[model samples]
Target: MNPAEPLPRAGYADVRIIAASPDIARRVADVLRRCFDSTEQRSYPAGHDGGTRLQLTVDTAHPAGPARSWLAASQPQRADRPQGSEA
Candidate 1:
């Protein structure tokens, strides 16, 4: 199947995780699976380099956990930062 083909259902998205090794690629995909319902990942060679690419379809409408939890927890509070300072 063509990787560029559109997903069959609404709220479904195609995702590709690329890394230097298969284990690293799979670890990133696993993080997404924790946040959303996803299909089995397909592995592929990224290029002439020894990199790995993994592709899968995730259901955005059906989140396995709070999608924004990690983001929210990691962001610093506005009051804790110096006013008018550039990040």
Candidate 2:
């Protein structure tokens, strides 16, 4: 699919991941697959860079686990005290 084209709405997203190798690109896609329902990855050459590009569609509405949990897990906790509470 053309990268310039607009993707469909309603939880559907067009994901394009570029990496130095096909295995790296597919590895990234695999991580997404573990979180969301997605289509098979389509591989392509990334211009003169000789890198690999992977494209796929993912349905965010149907996440494999509780939505936003991953986001929370990735957040960094404050190093300071708990605010108004004892350290």
Candidate 3:
């Protein structure tokens, strides 16, 4: 399979494993976490539920070595206007 290939799962937006190594995966994850700060339930609806709900995978099995990076399939959900409704 190619790096451009999609993951083997259902109901996902986009998923891809780019790195190849636990160290690299950790590095990448750190970078992503820093970059994608506020991507968790704690930062969500202010004591409501979840946040940037995304799913990712880090592979750890290869001839060369363990795989790194993550593949995720997710979709974002935002609220709309509540007309003629109680708050």
Error of 2 at 19 (Å): 0.4
The predicted structure with the larger TM-score, 1 or 3, is 1
Candidate number with the higher lDDT (1 or 3): 1
* lDDT of all predictions: 0.85, 0.85, 0.34
Candidate 2 structure quality by residue, lDDT tens digits, 46-83? 98888998999989777777445875677798877476
Provide TM-scores for the models. 0.69, 0.69, 0.25
In angstroms, the error of model 1 at 29 is 0.5
Q: How many backbone clashes does candidate 2 have?
A: 0
**Which pairs in model 1 have colliding backbones?**
none
Task: Please give the RMSD to the true structure for each candidate, in Å.
Answer: 7.9, 6.0, 18.1
List, in order, the clash count of every candidate structure. 0, 0, 2
lDDT of 3 by residue, 24-68 (tens): 544555554443322221111212332132234322221111212
Model 1, residue 15: distance off in Å is 0.1
- lDDT, model 3: 0.34
